[model samples]
Target: MYDVETRQRALALVAQGRSLNSVSKQTGISRAAIRSWQARPTPRLRRLAPCARCRPAPGAPDPADSYAYVLGLYLGDGCITRPPQHRTASLRITLDDAWPGVQQEAAAALRAVFPDNAIGWARKVGCHDLKVYSKHLTCLFPQHGPGKKHERPIALEAWQQTIVTAHPWEFIRGLIHSDGSRITNWTEKMSGGQRKRYEYPRYFFTNSSADIIALFTDALDRVGVEWKSAHQSRVARNISVSRKASVALMDLHVGPKH
Candidate 1:
C-alpha cells in the first residue's frame, strides 16, 4: 500500500487537474493505487469554519515583525489547503506535540496575522496542528506551491523581502525554532594528564530546499553571525553555529524554548 504522504500527494496532483497517468508517472505509483485513493471518502477538515462567510477577513499589513516570523515558520513546516467543493481554505502548521510552547507561539502567530479568523488546534499521533483559513494566506505567503517545496521554486514577494531584510534576526529565530534546533555539545579533554569534560552550545538548521537554506544563510549573514554546513549534500543541507560569542548573541535574541 502507498504511504499516507504518497496518497496525499497523489490526490493533490489529481485535484490540480493532472491526469491519473501523469501522477502515476511522476510519483512512481500505479494508476490503480491513485484511483483507490481518489475513490476513498475524503474526510472533512475538523475545527474549520463551515463556509466562506465564517472565514475571517482577508487583509493584513505587510513587513511587520509578526508577519515575517509567521512567514518563516510557514516556510519551514506548514501547508495550505483549499478543497474544490469547500468554500473556505485553511492554513495549517504542524509542530511537535511535546512542545506546547511552540504550539502556543504558532497559534499566537496565526491569531496575530488573522485577528478575525477562528484559529484552532488538533492533535495528530506525534504532533499538534495549528490551523487558520482565509484567502489572504496565498497573498501573504506567496511561496506556497504544489508538491514538495524542495522540488519547486520558492521566492519571497517584494514586500516579504522588505520585512525579512528589516527583521533578519526575528526571521532567523522563527526558522530555527521550526526547522532548526539548539543543543549542548560536549567533549572530553586531557589537561595536565587529567581527563576533563567540556561543554558548549550550538544551533543547527536542516532543510531540503536549497533556496530556503540560502535564505537562512543570508539572514544569518545579515545579522553578522558565523555558521557552517555540517556536511555537503544536495538531498539535505545541515548548517550549524557553535561559536561561543555567536551562540551568546543568538541566545540573547532567540532565547531558548520553554
Candidate 2:
C-alpha cells in the first residue's frame, strides 16, 4: 500500500486537471491506483510541500573517499583563498591544459564534497582550473596553509588519515592524477646477441611537499604498491613505481590519463 501522503498527492494531481495517465506517469502511481485513491470517501487532500531530498543536506560528512580524493588533489595542485569577510572560502585545482579528464575528475570530486555548491572551470595560460566556493571547503581542507605546501607544515587530520587508510587507491589516484603521471620508459638491452629496445609503463608522483609525498608513499605501502624516490634535485621530491607488478597495480587504480 502506498503512503497516505503519496496517494493524496496522486489524487490531487488528478483533481488538478492532469490526465490520470499523465499523473500515473509523473508520480509513478498506476492509473488504477490513482483512480481508487480519488474514489475514496476521505483521501486526505492536504497540500504537500516539496520533498526534503530536493534540497541538499547541510554539513555532509568529510571523511569519505570523495572527500579524501579531493584532499589529495588539494595537497598536490589545489589552492585555497580566504576572503577578508571570513565567511566563505574558495578551493581551486589547476590541471594541465592537455589533461581535460583530470579537470573533470577534480570537478566531480568537489561536487561530491559540496553537492550543493556549484563547480566552475576556466582556462588559464597553460592550465585548466576547477573552482568551488563554500564555507565548508575550508573546514574540509584545513591543511591549506600559507605559501607553498612544502614551506608549510602540512598534515592530515585523524579522520582524513582514517579515510586514506580505508581507500588508499582513491587517494593515490587523486595524487597521481593531479601531480603525477603515467609515463613510458624505454630501455635497450642485448637479446639473442642483438640489441633490442623495449618500452615499459610506469607511474611517477612528484610534489614539492615532502609531507605530501610521504602521505602518498604511505598509501602506496598500505596497498602493497611498491614505489621509490626518483628525484635528482633536493628542491622537489619525486617517487616512481617502475616495477612491472607495481606499475600494473597502479594502472589498475589510476589508468592512463585521457
Candidate 3:
C-alpha cells in the first residue's frame, strides 16, 4: 500500500516538468515506485496488499495541502511573464507624482496580505543615482526619485504594450544591440587593502524581434484583428505608409478609448 500523499507529490513534480529521474532523486523514492504510482488509476488501488516500505507515517501532512499552499504562493507573488527570468530595472515614482495616498495604502495592503513580511530601507555606499532600496520579506524593491539612475523601464506593462504597438521597430533594434555586446568586468577596492571583484557583463539585449512579432501576432489574433503578414513585413522595414496601412496601424495601436 503506497502512500496516497506521496503519489500525489510525484504527480505534481511530473506536471512541473521534472524528469522522472529528477523526481526520484528529489523524493528519495525509487524510480520503480514512481512508475507504479503513475500507472495506477485513481480510485483503484493496486491488487497487491500493503507494502511496508511504502506506508507513510501517521499524521504526515497531506500532499494536496502542500500543493495548495504552493499554488497560493505562486498566485500571490509569482511573476506571470514567460521564461521565469529576472532583470533589474529602474522604477521612478515620486511622492508627488503618484496619488498621495497610494504608497501608504499599498504598503498597508501588502502587510495585511503577507503578515510575516517585513519592509526595510537602505542606501548604497557610493552610488549617487540610487537613493534607497526597499527590502521586503523575500524580495528587494528598488525605489527611484529625481536623482537616481537605474535600468530602463522595459518591463512595465504599459511600456511593454507601447513597444509592441507604437514602437515595434525601436524595440526590435534595442534587442539587436543587446545581443551584440561582449563581456565586461566590475571591480572595486574597499578600505584596509581589501578588494572585491565580480565578473558580470552589463545588461545584455535580447535580439528578440521574432519573439515580439509572434507575441504581437498572437495578441492580434486573439482580438480577431485581420492583420496581414505583408503589412507586418513592410512595417518592420519602415516602408508601409499608405493611407489604408496608416489607418490599420492606428486602429491596432489605439483601440476605442472607452
Candidate 4:
C-alpha cells in the first residue's frame, strides 16, 4: 500500500511540469500508478494556510523585514515553479554550502514570512537549494514567469518596493548572499624604499538582469554606499563597491559569508 505522503510528493513534481516518466522514476512509482492517482482526486492530508497576498485586504507581507531579505535572495537567483494545473507553487533559493550560517539565516527568513509551510533542502554541486511550496507564491512573487529572469522584463510592484525601501540593508544583504561576493585584492607598493604589499577589500555583485542590478545599486544609494558598474558581456554586468567608506558600511551589514 502506498502512503499518502509519497503520493503527494509525486503530485507536487508533476505540478512543477516534470514528465510522468521522470516523476515515476524519481519516486520509484510506476507510471500506471501515477496515472491512476492523477485520474482520481485524493484530498490533501495537509492544506497550507491562505497566503498574506491572497488575503482579502492583500497588503504587504507581514514581518516585511524578512520578506525584504527573501525578496533580495529571490531576485538574485531564486525561482518559483508551478504548473497551471496545480494550486501549489514552489519557491526555491539557491544557497552556497560553504556558508551554512547564511543558509540557516535564509531558512529562518523564509519561515518568518511563510510560517505554517514546510521548508526542505535539496543538495546540488557546491550549493544547497532551499525550497518551500505554497498556493500564493505567485501572489507573493508577482515576478514569477516563464523563461530566464534575464530574458524577461523584471520590475518591482509598489508594495515590494515599499518593503525594500524600509529594509534596504536586509534586501542588500540577501542579494549579496545569493549572487554577490567579497574579495581582497593586493598589489605591491614602493614605500620607504621598500616594496610592500597593500591589500584592499571590495564587494561585487553580478547579474544578467539589468533591473536586478539597478535594484541592488538603488539600495546601496539609500545606505550612502557608492558603486561602480561595468558590463562583462552582452547580458551580464558587474557592480563593484570598492570605496573605503562603502566597503566599511557593507562590512558592518554584510561581511564575507560565514
Candidate 5:
C-alpha cells in the first residue's frame, strides 16, 4: 500500500501532464504499481440514519408520498395551467368517461420508458377560463403552440400514445443532446456560487475524427449497439489551423471509405 503523501504527490504529477513512466522514475515506484493504485476505489461517506423519534414511522404520511400522489394525479388526468391567485384550491375531478383510464395506461408506458424519473402531476384552476397542459401533448407534437387561455380539455391519452408510437428513439436520442447541454453547463459557470462540473474527462478522447469514431464505437459496443463506419467528405469552410500546410490538406479530395 502506498502512503497518502506519496499518492498525493503522484496524482499531482499526473495532473501536470507527466507521463506514468516519468512519474515512476521520479517517485521510485513501478508504473504498473502506480496505475494499480490509481485504479483503486476511494472510500465514500455514508449517511447515518436519523434517530427513531425524528424519523417517520412506517405507514405514516411522508412528504415523498404526497409528491408521489401528485405524480399519480398527473399521470391519470391532471393538467397544468396558470390559475388565478384568487382561487382557493383546484380539485382534479375526472369525468366518468374512459379518458382517465386511458391516461393512466399512457402514464404507465411513460413510466416503463423512464423508470428512474420522478414525474409529478397536478391540475390548475383560476377565475379566468384557461387551457390545460399535459406531458403527453408536449412530448408528441413539440411544435404545438404554447398553452392558451379558454382552451378546451386536451386528449391526454391520445397525445401520449402518439408520442410513444411516433418517437420511441426520441427518449434515448434526446439524452445525447442533453449530455452536450450538461457539458456546456459544466464549462459555463452560473452567477450564483454553484461550482461548474463535468461528468467526463476533457481529454479522454483524441482530437482526430477517427479517434472520436473509435471512442464512440467502443462506447456503442459496451452498450451492445452494432455500428458501421464509412468515410465521407470532409467539408471545411472557416476553420483556424495552426499550420498552413494542414489547412491545405483540407482542400484535397478524400475518397468515401472508412
Candidate 6:
C-alpha cells in the first residue's frame, strides 16, 4: 500500500499543475496511482490540508479569532452554494452598502481564514455580497446545508465552540454586523417643570432561528453581557441588550456596525 505521505505528496504535486508523467518521474509513483489518488472524494483530498473540522486531531483554524468572527457572520447572513458541475463551492456573505467598514472587515475575515481562495465582490440592490470560492469552505463551515438558515437547525461544532470561547467579542461583533444593530431611542420626560429629552442606546439581534438566538445570548452570557428577549413583531424575535452595563460592554467590543 502507498503510504499516506506518498499519496499526499503526489496529490500536492498534481495540485501544483504538474503532469501525471512528470509527477510520476519526480516521485517514482505510477501515473495510474496518481490518477486514482486525484480521483478520491473531496473530503478525502481535503484531509491533506489543515481543517479544524475535518482533521483527525483538529485544532482551531489558524487565525481562529477571525474564524470565530466569520462564523458569526456566516450564521447571521452567509450561504454556501455548490453546483453539481463545479468542483469548487462558493461562500457568500451579504452586507449592507451603508457599512463599508463592516464589508471590508468581512472580506478580510474571509481571506484570513481562506488565504488561498480567491475573493470577489458583487453588488446587489441595497447590499454587497462578499464572494469566496474554495474547495474547503464546507470543511471550514460545517453548518452549511439546504434551506434558509433560520428554517433549519444550526449548531456549532466542538472546535468552533472552542474558537468562540476564545474570541467572544469578535463573534458578537460579527453577529451584530450581519443581523444585529445598535440604535438610539429617545423619550420625553417632564423634570423640574421642564421638558427634557432622554436618549437610550441599545443593541438588538434579530433572528428567526431560536437556536441561533440562543447561541448569541449564550455567547453574551459567557462574556457577562446581559440581554433580554423581545418580540419586535408577530414573527420576529429579538435578543435585546439594553441594560446599562450590557450596552456599555457591547459598545466596548461590538459597538455600532459602521
* Best-matching candidate per TM-score: 4
Better of 2 and 3 by lDDT: 2
Across 1-258, the per-residue lDDT of candidate 1 in tens digits comes to 556666787788999999999989999999987887677533331233332222475333532778778877888888888989867778888888767787787778777667667788887999888888787667667787888889999887676777889888778877887888888999999999999999999988898999999999889888888999897686889999998888998899886665
Q: Pick the candidate with the highest lDDT.
A: 4
Candidate 4: tens digits of C-alpha lDDT, residues 1-258? 689989889888998999999998898999998888888645354465567777787789989999999999999989999768868889999998999999999999999988777789999999999999887888999998899998899999999999999999999999999999999988999999999999999999999998899899999999999999854788689999999999999999999988
> Ten consecutive residues with minimal summed lDDT in candidate 2?
46-55
lDDT of 6 by residue, 79-122 (tens): 99988998899988999999999999999988888765668999
In model 3, which range of ten residues has the least summed lDDT?
A: 128-137
Order the candidate numbers by TM-score, best to worst.
Answer: 4, 6, 2, 1, 5, 3
User: Clashing residue pairs, candidate 5?
Assistant: none
Question: TM-score of model 4 relative to the true fold?
Answer: 0.79
Model 1 shows how many backbone clashes? 0
Instruction: State every prediction's TM-score relative to the real structure.
Output: 0.74, 0.75, 0.19, 0.79, 0.19, 0.79
On residues 63-162, what C-alpha lDDT tens digit does candidate 2 reach at each position?
3788778877888888998878767788889889788777777788787777666688877899978988776555567697778889988888776777
For residue 119, model 4's alpha carbon misses the true position, in angstroms, by 0.3
**Reference-based lDDT, each prediction:** 0.79, 0.79, 0.35, 0.90, 0.35, 0.86
Model 4, residue 207: C-alpha shift (Å): 0.3
Candidate 3 lDDT over 1-258, as tens digits, reads: 558777888878987989889999998888888876777545333343232223463221122222222212222122222122423222111222122232343234333333332422222342111111112211222112232112222122342343335444322222222121223546786757887665533212222244333443444444434444432342231111223443344344432111
Q: After superposition, how far is residue 23 of candidate 4 from its true place, in Å?
A: 42
Displacement of the residue 30 alpha carbon in candidate 3, Å: 71
